[model samples]
Target: MGKNFTYLLGMLITIIIGTILYFNLCSDCIAGSSNNEVEQVVTEQATAPEPEPTSYPFAIANGDFDYSAEDNFNFDLSSANLRLPVSEKVDFGIYKLKDYLAENAGKVINITGLYSSKEANNTAFPNLGLARANDVKNYLVKLGIPSSQTNTFGQLKDELLPLDGVLLGPVNFNLADKAEDESETIAALLEKIKTNPLIVYFETGEASINLSAEQRQKVADISQYLDKVDGAKCLVIGHTDNTGSRATNISLAKDRADFVKSYLVRNGILENTIESSSKGPDSPIATNDTEEGRALNRRVEVTLN
Candidate 1:
């Protein structure tokens, strides 16, 4: 009986040990499952973020679009972008948009828009308003294209609507939805002149050169500036106040342009690079009846030819 009692105690101890081992093994399995669940949650959190969208500042929308910037990353909008629409509403000559494009060595420009005519000589067919959208297109591609960054657009027609005074003022200065994010060499030089024309002018009207002088320097500076351009030729146009008679004004305007051209030639500028003209009192910048207007009128202007 003692032996049997001892055997029973041993059996009980063995059962207890087996039960404890089973419980420990079950606990380890549960811990492993919990660890795997935590790892999966961390991995899921890491990979589920939002992505950003791509954008183009001067994005081409319409089918008729062409743009050029030597290094597009550093492009100026003047010659860095071009767009022209294929529409009958466009005029070939009056708007002079083609001339403007040619002058800038084929600036990248968009030719599709409600155009107005500022043609020096009105063409046989005039546009509805003063703008010539189609002429700009054909001129860019057909006539004298320096670059290939021009295009036409339909969506922009909606965005640039209703030409009111205040809105028109800001958009006139080659303004874009966003600033160009690149550095274009030609556009850079053009922009410098557009923004700060004084850097190329003398004080008022003296037969001297001053890169630092304002107003008159635009003429002399242009002569020096042409060298930096690839294939630049300019029309040096002269004008005068109505204070003088038409004949006298015309003569004075011619003299003024000649004087400028002579100075440029003296300074080693090629003579063929510039063409001279005299508008006299006909194309007064302001109402010449006023002193300020007269002064403004008695000046020379350089147009891209």
Candidate 2:
């Protein structure tokens, strides 16, 4: 029995030692494995690729025209000129836009040109934004889109990021509502024109005129009206202050009216359709006793007949 007990005890001690050694070796192995895992994680993190730069896409869309995920045009800082990107997709998209507009009648395009106040305005337009939009409109017109079907204006944008000194897709295209009945449209246009007639104010002895975007649009609308309504006439009436003699004032007023007529004729309106006259100092919309009133008096009133 004692010998049996001694053998059993020796087996117990051997089993204990083996357990201890195994645990110690396993701990070391576990530690080594953990260290290797950490190293692998670090290596992977270091070898990972950097994220790509952000891309600004240029696109155009309308009712029938699908939005194309392609760059069409780019512009330099403070520039109104269009810089075409090196992509055939642009041409395809433009042709598609043109086709869509041609197929869809009575629909008009409104082009909004975005500009930053930080940019310089060097164009003859009222602002860089309008000039940019007008350039785009002109391009579309050259592409066979009717000038009457496209209208342009400017919008101020505070957030315009330029990539390498170039602005991508600075213009936006929106389709205006389809025209209603022809007579209804004409009546509405006439009401608007008469209620808010384009009154171009002039300085003393100044012949050059600069029109605002709204005024320019009015001129376009008038041109469109004259094109549609046969025998319609555009009357340009000039008024003056009572500063000079009646005859001299009438002559000055006549010259102003003639200048306005020329301007209208230059903008697609037929010269023969326009009639110019001078009211001299007889028709003053304001008091001629003050400078401000006199300034208001030196004006040309455009009306549709």
lDDT of each: 0.46, 0.77
Q: After superposition, how far is residue 74 of candidate 1 from its true place, in Å?
A: 37
For model 1, give the 10-residue run with minimal summed lDDT.
71-80
TM-score of each: 0.33, 0.52
Expressed as tens digits, the lDDT of each residue in 1-305 for candidate 1 is 99999999999999999999999999999999999999999999988874332112222222333322221011112111122332222333212444555454434554333322221212111221112232333344454443244433211221322222111211111212212532365456555565544311223456654332243345434433454464777667788878858998899888888876675554334577778888888887589778776777777665554
Model 2: pairs clashing at backbone N, Cα or C within 3 Å: none
Best by TM-score: 2
Model 2 Cα shift for residue 226 (angstroms): 8.6
lDDT computed for candidate 2: 0.77
Clashing pairs counted in every model: 37, 0
In candidate 2, what residue range of length 10 has the lowest lDDT sum?
51-60
